[model samples]
Target: MPKCMIDGKEVEFTAGENLVKVAKRAGVEIPVFCYHPGLSVVAQCRMCYVEVEKMPKLQTACSTMATEGMVVKTNSENVKKGRAGTMEFLLLNHPLDCPICDKAGECDLQDNSYGYGSAYMRGSEERRTYVDVNMGPVIQKNMNRCIHCTRCIRFGDEIAGIHEMVAIKRGNDIDITTIDGKTLQTEYAGNYSDICPTGSLTLKDFRFKKRAWMLKKTTTVCEGCSKGCNMEIQHEGDVIYRCVPLENLDVNRYWMCDEGRFNYQHTQDPTRIIEPKVKAEGGWKTISWEDGILGIKEEIDGQKPTFLVGSDLTQEELTHIKEYIALQHPGATIQHFGTPGLTSTQQDGALDQILRMKSKTSNLNGAEKLGIAPLMNDTIKADTVVVMSAGRAKLPKINAKRVIAVGVYLEGDASQFDMILPGLAFSEKDGTIVNHQGIEQKLKRAVLPRGKCKSLSEVLMLLTNKKARVGANP
Candidate 1:
């Protein structure tokens, strides 16, 4: 351990820890452009300069290690002046096009300028400009707004292990661009949008769509696949703005697949089933929640009933449904269904391996929690079957007299059921889902379910003999 004084306050930190890390630990934020916790220390920005005792000049706090008895002044007049000057120099070549930029509201440069930089520009020379390069289909690059942080270039090489991007030239002419004008094609390429401090890098899909401040952010786990990557969903008035990685070290670790990031739009798609329906002589007819449950119970009472559980439902919903079935029919058989596989990643390791798990949602954990035993292949005989949610691969082939489909999506060849119970999507319901790592997270109701659609919990309460409690936290 090494003891150091920051802004006249005594503090102790790990011996080999950088001064910037120690300062952040002590509730001090050093303005930085190129510094990242996972990457190697470059200390190129010089924005984190701090005044130190016995030092001839200000030092880069990001790379400088604190020594015993070292006195560091992070908020000193000289240090603040140095940071303001450095920010000005960095902004000299910037385009100052925040009005039209996608990163305007949440940009680090916009925040740092308000904290440290002068209001007016000092230089009279024409701003340096560069042609915007076509990086890839997913990412748009605006070179003129770049601050030479090299975070993007480092991210491609270090985290993604793809050396597709690099810095070209030297001195005042230094710029980051890809060789042979190649596009950035990597599985983890989307992460650069978060790492980039300015509007230099932006997602092609989310460009000019919505301002960051206008969107409501909800922290939820990604259900695109079984990896259960931690994520934050940004939306406004039923429209999803964007999906970003929520850093959970035990889970996704600040990274989520591009598929998981953009797949949330399906939940709000127009084709999604929004109400409860029952199979009639004409076709599927919209019915009330009570009517739907009564129809299901009538079919179950008529013959042997089978229950098909989808992997997309949360653990709590799964547990409650299984419990309801057990209480109704003590020996009823339940079948499991999994969603089809999506695009897999090329990376290896526990983190990546976990991300590639084929069962996309946390429903497996839910089934386990409820102690609902899955029916084996030998136990396929049944007269009535109740299907829950989507994903029917785990379900056994049965010759049931009556089939009940309960889900938001009309999926698979098992749609010839007598009763169809329309369920709400994850975004249309309020419940908690447990990720693969056993971390519990809540999903809020983003929009009202269209038509006669109802949540699984609501339908279960109606069907079960036990009265469901209101405002229960799972």
Candidate 2:
């Protein structure tokens, strides 16, 4: 490791590490706008001004690589003046809409301006503004808030492998918009909101939703696919507001696909079955947990029910299901099902060069590791069928006389089921899932189980209990 001095403090750095990274490691903060670790550094913002001992002028820390015996001053008078000038220029056209902006608390511009910007303005001319362009469903375009960091533009070309977003003009009049003002054509469009320094690009799903500081964050992995991109579930009062990518350099880096980013919406959907329900003559009727457990037992009590375990389930949940099936129904056919037509790990691979995976479920490899075979031809061959899922895997076709669904389900998903035992979503459960790379990650519980939802362990306990405590107050 090479050594450097940042603000009079000695610091160690690896070869080729930038000053912005090395300075931060030494507890010295260098403000930045266009210096996302995951993206290429352009030094376009010119905000990370640092004074090198021998250099004549201030240098942008993002593009300045640290070298042996290099001495960098981050908070000198000249550096502060340079950074303050840069901050003033950036805030020249940026609207004072922090109160209404979705990126208020988390905006890098807000934090940098308060720390480095001048309180008074010198320019008397009218501030430049542009008509907001439509960037399609995932992102809301607000050109008025852009500072031309070009993070979104680089992300599209380098990360998403799509050159959709582009800068049409140069200098202060530059505008970052999709090509021909077209709708975004990338499956990873949600990342545009994550990498943007300001509120220029914000998530449409999170617009006007909740204040960033008000929501609690839960670090978890995406169960949407086998990629297992790390993400944070932002929620308030047990209600999820949004999901954002958490940087894991090994797995998802700093980006997550729109499918994983907006996947939490299904958990909070209005028609999701939160309470235990039994299919009646007229329609579905709400039942207590005790009754729901007994109802499931009644359906497949003496029969060898075929257990269709979803590969989306966590290793803990799937292991429990396998053990429960073995004790409850010996010699019963049990198979794991996720994406239809994609059975084994051999069929699971990268959907794109990016983070998306072909296997829609998170634990396809884990299921295969547990000795559970994939459902053959996506078909079931039994009189009684029990389907267990965490609501990520596609539901397989069932031709059985009695069908029981035990997991999260929406109203439309219950049409062919005899009974529904509500279970926790990935956001409400703590368990482990193995990714496509064979790296195991833990899913942290962000909220309590919604309504009458119970864990698979609890449901299994009730079914296996010899002392039939039926109708005994849920």
Candidate 3:
């Protein structure tokens, strides 16, 4: 219960806590560029300067520890002038092309410049620029907007555990590049753009797609794996534009792996099977929702079934499937399948030293928690197999006489199934999923189900109740 005076207000902070956190409690703003809560505090940006009562000069709030009984002045003339000077210096060589930059609306450098910097320039010298290098397929580099904050450098070293990004030179000529201009090698490379205070690094997938201000954001969880890294899905016109990590200290912290970051791609894939289809004399024929349910009932009618639930499904969906099986198909066999070659949570381990897990599915632990056993190769003897999942789980090869797939899937994924009932993806449904650590997280609905896709619960209702209406939002 240590107390410190920030501005004029007494703020209590944990001993050894930095002034930035303490200032935040007292509603005092200390601008920072190099300091990320998840990364090491380098205090190199010098943008979060504050005037201490007994100290002669300003101190960097990001690195300064708050001592009990110490007074701080974040808005004093000395601190304001110090911050303005830092802003001016940072903007000295920064490109003034905010009109076209993708980071225009959300760029920290732009906001700081307008808030703390003087309107008139102190120097009319030529600005610095460098030829951009291709970091990789995930990131696009623009050295002209680089602020030399070293955030990406520190993130790669301290968090990612990969020392791939480095500064090649010193001072004004310093070029932040990979070793020998090699392409980015880390699987977490998408985070390079997320942690950048400026648009020096931007995601290639999100580049030029939409302005940062134009998209609507939905707080959600990543369905890529069991990590369940919190994320935000941004969209406009009911179309998802991008996904970014949401901070969860106990889980993903301030970062998400590239696999989870780009997992939204499949949801918006053009080749996805959006309409219900029934196999007939032809390869596959588009069928109405009513007819689709009728066809499924006819196929599974009077035949013993082996239900293969995808471990990628949320806990709510999994529980619903369990209840449905118990009530409707009492003698039917129900098992879970996901992440080929990986069955039980016992076989699941870290794919890397960091976030990636060996099991590709998000709810393998949840499925196990529900007393659902892993499906084995020998369990494919039933006359009909009903496969269900949101999307991340890969379908196992089925040799059953009749195969009924009831989940979001792509046309290319149609090779192993006989009938398809279009279902919602992770972003299109609201449910709960337990992660590898047994922490239950919520998967929020970002957009309505794309095309004719329906929720799994609704599909089950349609299958069970002849009176239930079947529609996209149902």
Report the number of the highest-TM-score candidate.
3
> In model 3, where do residues sit more than 4 Å from their true spots?
467-474
| TM-score of each candidate structure, all chains considered together | 0.86, 0.97, 0.97
Cα error, residue 321 of model 1, in Å, equals 1.2
Model 3 TM-score is: 0.97
lDDT of 1 by residue, 335-357 (tens): 55553322112211143532445
Error of 1 at 132 (Å): 2.5
Error of 2 at 173 (Å): 2.5
When sorted by TM-score, best at the front, the candidate numbers are: 3, 2, 1
Q: Whole-model Cα lDDT per candidate?
A: 0.73, 0.88, 0.87
Best candidate according to lDDT: 2
Candidate 2 lDDT by residue in tens digits, 1-474: 779998889999999999999999999889999999998999989999999989998899999999999999988899989999999888888778999999999999999999999888787768788987788898999999999889999999999999999998887788888899899999999889988889989999989979999999999999999999999999998899999999999999888999998899888787889888888989989998778877777777777888888899999998998888888899999998989899988988889999899999999999999999889776676788888888888887788888888765454558868888888889988999999999999999998877777777777778888665634222
State the number of backbone clashes in model 3: 0
Worst 10 residues of 3 by lDDT: 465-474
- Give the candidates in order of lDDT, highest first: 2, 3, 1
List clash counts for every candidate, in order: 8, 0, 0
